[model samples]
Target: MTMKRIAPLIVSLMAALVAVLVVGRPEHADAKADANPGAKDVIVHLFEWPWASIASECTNVLGPKGFGGVQVSPPQEHVVLPGAGYPWWQDYQPVSYQLQTRRGDRAAFATMVSTCHAAGVKIYVDAVINHMAGGASTGAGSAGSTYNHYSYPAVPFGNDGFHHCGRNGNDDIANWGDRWEIQNCELVDLSDLRTEAEYVRGKLVAYLNDLISLGVDGFRVDAAKHMPVADLQNIYSRLNGNPYIFQETIEGGAGEPSPSEYTGIGDVTEFRYGDVVGNAFRDGNLSGLQNLPSQMLLASGDAVAFIDNHDTQRNGRAKLTYKDGTNYALSEAFMLAYPYGTPAVMSSFTFSNPEAGPPASSNGTTNAVNCSSGWACEHRWRTTANMVGFHNAAYGTGLSNWWSNGGNQIAFGRGANAYAVFNRGGTLNRTFSTSLPAGTYCDVANGDISGNTCTGTAYTVNSSGQFTANVPANGMVALHINARTTGGVTTPPTGCGTVAVTFASSTTTVWGENVFVLGNRAELSSWNTSGGVALSSATYPVWRGTVDLPANTAVEYKYVKKNGSSVTWESGGNRTINTGSACTLTVNDTWRS
Candidate 1:
């Protein structure tokens, strides 16, 4: 459950029916692929991290680690419960769609998205749309919008906006087993929005589209199970573009609106997969993880996998977590190395009390995240970070040359591209066959390659394509074609993936006047009007340039027709282009909208 603190039992209801997604079914289906078209396939859940911190992390840790995307905490304005020590769950109680919160203002959020996307890291905002503030409180929201139990002025939602489940103005879901009541009733004291109302659906879709326009790659539909699937299909159908959408339909066991019911819309978080991976790692059972509980879940292509989310970590239901130390790392390594479903790594702030808020600044707003400051930052750990790269290098390839010591130990190759081994129990010597063509390789799990030198243990595979090595207890070792230094079947690391920019100008241009792209991004021109990358007018009407940029990047550039000393800039908002997972992508856009 993404929301916990205040009402554990209510979240319990959420955690039960936790995840769902689908694609390749029909027009209703989102594409049958990972969120980001060609991303690393590893999405990190940076829970409650401040915007600037998230930006810094995207550039330094996450981008370099090859993480495809970041699932940031909800960015919408919400309740600020200082009276309750400002519980973290308070943010989950959204008061309005205003992009203002303890994290940052609307501008900060937009910058964070562009920055992360520029670094090849997609941003998936946690969208808490199922309900608003739970208790019957009368106060101004974080964005200074006044709100009550049945009224929210920021979104201008009134009495007609909420569901009338009837209980002294509160409609608590007394019976979770009843699908209708669960969907229509209030979760705790929270006022459930009447999503069936056209006004409500429009407002919600508009808010989501605003984020998409701001450049977010996708969304985590918080408490999606609480809303009717039909309402969801309508809302998503009307989105600007197919942004990555995964829902939180937490009715765990087989029951009403099975995960398949939501599959036609977007990817679903397979909570059961988390339980399986967590338990297997915690208990050192490699075989149990081989066959997942796919009977009642969506297909691998439709599922978002995670080891332990916010709620499961706090509620003691997860098998491994930051508290578990080595076991947690081992489990995460397994999650990435194994090709089960789209993985989401949880990077939460360290908290002693479940209800405790983030480290606040002097103004009581969430402080700038300092990983050293009680934040788990699990996504930055050596094992997890390197595994992200391993996953990237290995994705699009299926498992081969699979080897297991029958139970607690296992080693597998992602075709011939990657090979990883995990020794959950007491380990020493073991030999495994791999598709790799016999060569010395660097063990990225221990230390990555620098220059062309290996910083850690180097394993040499014989001509027979077999390597014998001793793995540590509860240790993980991963080596992929993308991690190799010198020889072998390694593909040189494509650093700072590039994107192609083609500008088609509608403006009148003379023989001497040439169109050039310039922007605040260094790749564009460092905002220098004169030094902007000149576009080729091979085809008089269109100008183009293949610009090298960081993967998953966003650039705000404008086309300017330059004749030498003088320049005519496009008179409009800066045109933006967000790059994807490809080594190089093409952005065909007009000069100015």
Candidate 2:
């Protein structure tokens, strides 16, 4: 949880709560081993999803899609603000450690974890242990737990169990560089818990053990950056079974506490990964991502990699999201396709209004997710879900056969087990050398393997270990040894080096107006508007096309609109584009409408 709070309500006192168990799982039961699942794990954060929907996705979607696990939102009872439309961040304001949340009750959560585990998928709870609801009186909590700045009867934490925030009139993390202030101070007036106290730690331990008993495999420690690392070590050391724990310690630049401070305690979130990946692809610089800077997160083995998370995606630090369209999807493809850290898929609901909660009832209890109800089920996209299989197939293999067009165009193989080619800034019609046993394999990028048939394109690896294809602009293709089409494998004949060059453009036109692109080159119909290739308006206000063109040629072009006998030419200088020396290139532009 980042420290940014939406709004606040007056806090009150704790109410009668249930007694928590002190002991953890039985002695013989392991915490570490039990929490960590097997290899090729790709954890998807089902942000704010209801427990029932998560269960259904595990059986009908996650299991079949090869997702290793899910990182669910914080399930603790929290403050309910009808006035705020029940912002999703409300989950972070813990009123109690109880697992009953607006998403579902305790029974629902238990069922979800069990169901997911049964389907070979683990459940990682997002543990918000740092603080409680803000304010000092009159709290309105979801689970009916009454809480004040120092009184949470649900956990029965009183004045002594929390920090004296207003004692000397402290500021809300006024200086991020000051470690003491960051740890002890209240975040946006949220009551900071006394994790340093043994009493609080015991309650937290019991809560976590309870979750483990309910079949939770691990936890994502929220706002860990705001808590003491030593205290965290203490809490983990007292646990019964080793639950996989990854702390949410966002590296907010140099002045913030180094994420390394909490590294030995558990796996940490590497926020730098997304920003770097986004910038590289956005700027058409592929090689930049491969060579990470020292300041960036490079300990891939011990870090969690993602294109964006809830906070960064909403707060503008994350460079890409569903809103970015093609580039957004491209980031995920590139991340998963690369042999780096464990990848996480972001599955979130759509909201033009950032503070709005998930699809919910009038009371803010989230309704079951149905994709059509304003949720972006990105994990279900063929491009994302299918890549999980490829990531699994290529696990533990070292990167080999690295090749690049010295620009954004690149291709590489995973030790002959799999191959991937990427093209941005234009098209990619280049061949790369490989060492695979010649055979036909499904291009997992286009689609998944349905039994013996590849739902995508089929490519044959030549006897000499070479792959040839023309990836369209903002497109890519992938193949793995494990995903070979039944008869897709074959020996390649001689002469396999050329790739298709696709010329493309985008423009906005009013209704009834069609856009056409023509240029001063043979590929552009020799600048003849009537003979020019027709652009598709299937995506209204935008047009695109892929055309076969001679490689290594420079051309000038412009867009023209036609409707019956009427015609409109873009009023501007002739646009110039280049076909790279390689077999592919892309000319991207917008009409000067």
Candidate 3:
């Protein structure tokens, strides 16, 4: 079958299936492209936008702006929170797997997906499977499906799929130390699911496969860290292969699952990158970004880097303040230029209260996301948007000719295809080696190309590979060789391939035992000791153990703590592994792997 013939057939099939499943029309081809990767560098998170609005944005703004994909809010039926003023978290509550929510119904969602796909912009759904609504009595969701905290009638999940909250509603995760409880226990009063069950896995897979059949490219698994690694692996394996799966595991420090656990199944969200970039930009410390290369090298392939996300924006008591729009723009632009994990930029509207929803009307309907509506479309800013073009032009490239003042000024070449300078200090006037074939190129940060001429006051790159440009305070400059000129370096090196590592232990405990315990200190280790190497620690109550490993190597090691006069491991002999290079160990049974 030729590409032309296969395309229509696929669309027709999706339309028919979606029509039969629910009373709705199929999404247009352009909406489907929101998750599929095209020859672009940007993926806008169209928060709370309806399918119709999204389709329009693709044709009017995203397509012309050079966006590769769009991560849409959860499309599944969710809790309708009227008390919280219908906040965005309402989507976090899963009433059913049906494609119906605040954004649109099943038909509208399908149409949006197909429409985006037609425009060469992929659609990635934010899959929230960790838990149901925080606190809700009635269970008729936005899709009209009946659900209860103890049971979901539409999906028909029973007690086997849930875990009861122990005294104080903690479930004793600190004591029992079981993966099952962590996944099945309530999170912030939200009902969790038992993903390990084959039936549950099948349902999840079916929902995702339905989306894939509708032309979605991947999913953003929300609250993934709270789930079991094995269960996630199982669910992902059952879903359509080749779909982009980015798990949300907020591991900031050295230890924890390290995003490596889920890398085999799909890319994991790198939450720490947001903090690093946000802090560096806000403080005007460009040198803090110099260590990005090191972090990228450690991230391997599972890193799904991003700026401020929904949770972080809601929880202001966190790192990298994103309330400031200027700093947010600088951070996003920097991420676009830096060679890091698979990048996903945050496109959000302005909000005064942390729990506030996107710009909404008096009737509680989400307002259309437009620049004039007080929504900070940071992704559309001149500097940020141009950097997206630069990123697309320099895809698969590595950082070369890195030049930094070790302070508030930095510049680097992206495989000679593009070069960028970030000056957080005062105005910057520097002549840097672009490493591009001598030719004039358009400064993407400032302007566009038209009829072989760079329009606007965009800085120009001379034929000598030496371009002197001034980046005003809190501003940046990026020059792309392919923006207006031809014949520049296009190739990049292929680094070492990745590896998959799993950890197992003799104990079937929910949470692993505390292997290390000191006065006011405790440590835990969960490694797969059956296949990989083992880790040993000294028997010191107040002492901690540290381990270092290579990139892309998977090994399991157990933890041992110092007792009064002896060393002891977790009671269940719990074992864990580290998959990446950089990791840390802290107290309180926390293995910052």
Candidate 4:
């Protein structure tokens, strides 16, 4: 779909590929799937979204919803193919290393990166390093740089910098059977860079280093299979820091490059994951979905899982996409709830033509995203967005309380923190067993939880950690400890003088975890983890939040790290704070643990 000419081939060859263990990854490829530890673990690919739009979304939706990172489309000067109707794939053809594209200019891109970081969201760029513009695209590029086959001058690559494999009379990759040609020759007549050469590698490293200097946290290596593993390893080693790196390696036939071969360099996008998980939901089968990790090609830590992506959604390879309606929603929810690989949710724009670009001007400058009109915004769907909380809440816990109806119904629990049930057959009323504590929980799947109330459905778990409810057909019921109903700060007792107390905690955290302040007082949620006042990571390494408290009162409080389902209390005893008669006060403390 992106002019790689490999999508259809990979899709048809999926049946022949086999899953293998990934071993012998290079030591330099210590790229983690979760770039920002202690943040949420989900990465939403806002495909073709403008830089400015992404910044706003980070502050408004992603940060609030607990998403970890965003895989943005390429942010470099690329080819502009107006004659081809300004196809979406045009962005894949590079004209230069300049950070100027349809998305925005260099200044805007830098602002986006800073804005997202301030909101606790990391940015992963889609790095297209396999080749430059195709030989047929002869003209000025998006940033007015002109180039021909192997003659780009902006980055100053010449014919000597490319690989002319001298095969098939045109030097194009006509045979996928040959491993050398697949990696060295031009893909679809695009000029392939000689990655083995030190000069070429240096140029590539500079491009990547430039992005890293701009505070880009990670990269989705586009068309990584075209470059050898050694070349990638060498390039990665040269990076300033170990930002998260996941490559797009479409599994090929037996002799061709295997996705497993690239795992040593970094995480690989497990295309097979989409097939196994998507088909399970599309077929309405819940029996075999639990064993997904063992069935995947890469290990849980090395795989980047997704139900559908930009390429698959355009091609017919994807089992269920945004077009599939409820089935797709259920599939996304299941992917999040199930403990598998690192999840990257897809948020895309609507398109009937697989080659069509997003809504843009005649000059191919992409317009700002408008979700209600052209964008699918699948990540914002109630079932998908709310499930992120479930994923975070259930982090580090293993699946328990597994139950199935031997048909299209299933229920499971994530330790004692979260529980969920899916009903695809019919409205089945049943009492579900769980390990959650007794409390009234908001069913996040059907509604949003605000304060202590649920906007839609609510269920009460008894002391035995069991709840009785009728799950609707084609629906789900999800509850996490964070969504429990609890009355918080009951109108700060009538005549008490209030002072704004700002709590600042300097502590580090792992993925899916956040810092909160709670204490033994009505104003501080009374030590209820569910009702604790959450601190923001706007100024990271320093979690800060302000809350009103009774003046001139001694409050026993402590900072705790909370994921959705579990709470990790600070070591030692409780921290005591005094709210003086001053109108406002600030308390700065380090993490005791």
Candidate 5:
């Protein structure tokens, strides 16, 4: 049989295996291999760590901690705010996509990528693609690329590449209610690119593809909600077809674009989490914690969850701050223990003030991340790192037998492999159902288990699935079915015998549903379908017109948009098509690429 004919059968068999695991009550089963592409549980947001240091951290710290990946600072060259003491926000501005920056030169960055990938830790680049540097006049970026927004001679980005200020003007972003104006207009005097244009898309793709070629796994699209949803979709389609695109849409309250707009295309940062955790911790209301797992269950699986990010740490008032020290550690520990949207824990250094930069050299380069300089390497905290391992081990599991007092104590089992509890109330004793095979397990938060026994405060689960333990005031506890005295499962899942493919692109307009048409005579050869048979496209390269996809089976696909020949793929390698969406001759891949 041809490759096309056999591909569907392979996918079908895999899907069936996954279904049985998801629905059947199997004993001590591991996570399904193809569960979620980026669903390894713990992700470390290595704020402001230079590339070289990050590469080492991934190898020595993150890899051993069982973290799925690391979200690095913006890798692109940005404006250097010397007056601000090279504050972290300086990197938020972009002059060009040169690999040369404070993080390290191109060579250093390449080494970081290769080194991290070798250790099984994926690198998610913080891509500031929405706008250029906020205040740039010298045309020369830190990477030595000369770029004047008016000229941008080094990048050859002339007036044609940018969007002109609207009638409202550059600083009028707060006044303009339309998303187009927010995206197209200059953000705080920054240079805004016209992502809809073909020439612009090509340049952005060239930069992103370069990173992908260097082994970068995905992107955290900065200021995503500022751009049009359609535009982002188009850009994503053109770039690396379905590369990991996580949009930074700060949806704080009710009046913002729902993560749904971007969820169809790629994972989006769920900013509400900061507020949820902040309010819960500050108010000392553990009942507030009860709502979290349920809320996360409602979130799309691709949602990127975080307790505190760089922006929140600097701007949000009620949000968790590094200054809080121990409180921050406790909050992060709870975040990791609870299964939510894919979690990316914040790691930071000490700063006297919010505007302070990382420990820096007189020459202006960012210093290494250190705890002694008052930097709170929250990831290094025992509870935090142990939870990271717990998350990895509980990867495809759902919350079962959840127990919460509607106050300071909460506990739940992740699948059957792990169980955890948090005590925010004053010290107390309680008996709860753990659902573990009646045996002794180490409380991972205190210490790990060893040789059928736990080291520190080992708890025994009676035949009734009840275990008694005391949760000290402002403390936490965890017990894993399988973990060593000093370790838990540290390996991420590698799917069974399937080669993965990803798409990288600059803008979403080219292959967006709104842009392409059936009669437009678009070339659709770069796209392919996996679950069933026969996939075709119309004018839009990203649109998968119709196919005979298998019922209740998962599929993966990629697209190549026409703007200077850009290619994009799904964030994860697969998406399940429920039986309701499948038919004999027609099934639509409407869940974006």
Candidate 6:
């Protein structure tokens, strides 16, 4: 998130005028690698998360759920402003390119990259290359490197590397219309780097290349609009590989640099996406969203869409947050369900004060993530997390079977792979036509399918491709091929001779202990405690997972709660199931006290 919210009233007036002007969408960059390297397209920004916590989440949560990538906070040495109660923006102020901060040291950063890669999830670093620390910040950085205005000795950037654009008494940006001042002048008194200078470009390239060498797959270039597009292209050309680059170019008025100017090089952040989607959901208007792509600043392929980022969430621009409850969840679900740009989901910590930092120690080092407490963990919401599977299953499919009440109720489909309905008003009772084949699907938005049982609601599509449902107010029902509750046909098709067994356990757990299942067969780890198949808590108090067990086999399994090395087995004789010749089966069990 960029701090470009200066003179918003003026910018808004100009933006209204610029919206009508037609401009050809720039061709997307051919040199860029896949923004999401995994099979899934959704990426989550774990805002202000510690390196160790992020590594663990990648293995246990993101990778297992098919999340493609994680966008981490800046890993470079940055200003530490303890006097100001250690504001979150401090991490955006770079003191040097050294990979050391409250998050972790260079070694920890390297470990995080490799760990996430092993889980098949990519890491995109928030690259702060357009500037250094603010003019007022003068102190030793998080890495113990001293830094002052225009003189970061750790990065060896002397005063010559900065631009002293002679305008506005303090050389800070004041005119929102002047393109030159917007790019050359300091933004809110941050020491702007002269990106046009070769020396400065070389230093930026080195920093990015260093991260690449450590296995980082991409970058979220902060304050990208403040740099010349040519300068960015030149720097990108020198980087090791074709890393995914999404520039932060907030859509501005006609005179200022437009997001379109930056899309030629790579995908640009579509800030308008949040405002449009947020307001629609907030105002209970579903009809306008049908024209969502036309209302955006960039083309779908050249844009990175998001509802609210770290900055927008605090700046009063966000129409909804975790505080908005159901509306926010619906907004995220709509973003994933709709075919738009690559979606970036935000996972933020709760904050009362706008400038307050994340949950941290006395010394300001960010603490490990505790989703039940300080963190919102919105990305892990059953609706949001499960929508990722819907998005993936619906990939390469086009919109079909569109239905709407023309007000607050709507339903749509992604070809034959997925279908969804949203009701922001009263109970919506109607039959929905879809392209999906005849079968049973779990309503992922409300619950999940474990084995053959649906935890929330189950809807069966008739051979004619239609189902009747009563979607409640502020409620949603989404289904996809990946979450089919019956039959052996999965999104990626399980091979023959194996049956899908979904294990649903109605058991509670302490904070640390998690529910897992181990059984007599190899698929169930042969009662090996270490090899227990972990179940998902997305729908808590009902841990569930689907395992492909051999057909025509008798399996004995027991649910256990594991906290580290300790395992608490359910107090019961072994529960048995006969995997008959049927392709799918479900075994529902309650933990015996």
lDDT tens per residue, model 1, 193-293? 88876666667877887787676767999888888887887777656434678988764543455666777778888877777777788888886555554
lDDT of 6 at 352: 91
**Residue 435 CA displacement from its true place in model 2, Å:** 3.1
TM-score for each of the candidates: 0.81, 0.77, 0.72, 0.78, 0.74, 0.78
When summed lDDT is taken over every stretch of 10 residues in candidate 1, the lowest stretch is: 16-25
Model 5's alpha-carbon lDDT is 0.60
Top TM-score model? 1
Tens-place lDDT per residue, model 5, 1-593, is 00000000001334334434433332222221112344454678888888888888877877666676788887877666565577666777666678878888888998997676545577788887766654334535677665544445445555656677665644435544555566666666666767665555556666776676566667888877767776666556544323456777765334445556767677777767767876676557766665574554237476777778776676654377667765676778777766678787888877656677787787677646444565567787788887887776676777777887877677788867778887777886888787666666677788754454555787777777778999898777787655633223422222211111212222245332222211111122223321111122322333322211223434433332333234334344433323232112223333344
State residue 471's C-alpha deviation in candidate 3, in Å.
2.7
| Consecutive 10-residue window with the lowest summed lDDT within model 6 | 4-13
Which of candidates 3 and 5 reaches a greater lDDT?
5
| Alpha-carbon deviation at 151 in model 5, angstroms | 3.2
Worst 10 residues of 4 by lDDT: 7-16
**What shift in Å separates residue 71 of candidate 5 from its native position after superposition?**
0.5
Instruction: Judge candidate 6 against the unseen true structure and give its global Cα lDDT, from 0 to 1.
Output: 0.80
Q: What are the runs in model 1 whose C-alpha is more than 4 Å off?
A: 2-37, 167-169, 254-256, 293-296, 489-492, 496-593
Task: Write one digit per residue (lDDT tens) for candidate 3, span 1-593.
Answer: 00000000001333334433542222221111112232343567777676777887776766555676789988888776665676666767777788977777888787886566545466788887765544346647787776665556666655565556574454423322444444555666676666655545556767887776565667888878777777776666544324667777766333334555656556776767877777788788877676675654236355777787767776662355346767777788888888777678776777776667667665456646455585666677776776776777677888887888888888888876788888888888778887776655677677766546566554545667777777788777777765654334322112111111112222221222223222111111233221112222212222222222233553434544333345454444433444442222222343322
Q: Considering only N, C-alpha and C atoms within 3 Å, which residue pairs clash in candidate 4?
A: 25-264, 38-510, 38-511, 393-564, 393-565
- Candidate 2 C-alpha lDDT tens digits along 1-593: 65346222122233212222333223232122212334637999999998999999888888766687899988888877777777887888888877778888999998897677656677889998888877633465677877666566667766666676553374366776777788888887777878876667777877886776566767899899989777887777655345678888877655677787777777888888888888877777886555553436647666788888888777778788888877888788877778777788898788787777888878787755567678898888777887787787678787788888788887787887788887785877777788776888888889767667776798888989987898998888888876786433432211112213333456766656667778887546688766564565534455654444444567788888887578889888988766544423446666675
Candidate 3 deviant stretches above 4 angstroms: 1-41, 165-181, 252-257, 296-300, 317-322, 367-369, 458-463, 485-593
lDDT of 4: 0.79
Q: Once superposed on the true structure, which residue ranges of model 6 sit more than 4 Å away at CA?
A: 1-39, 488-593
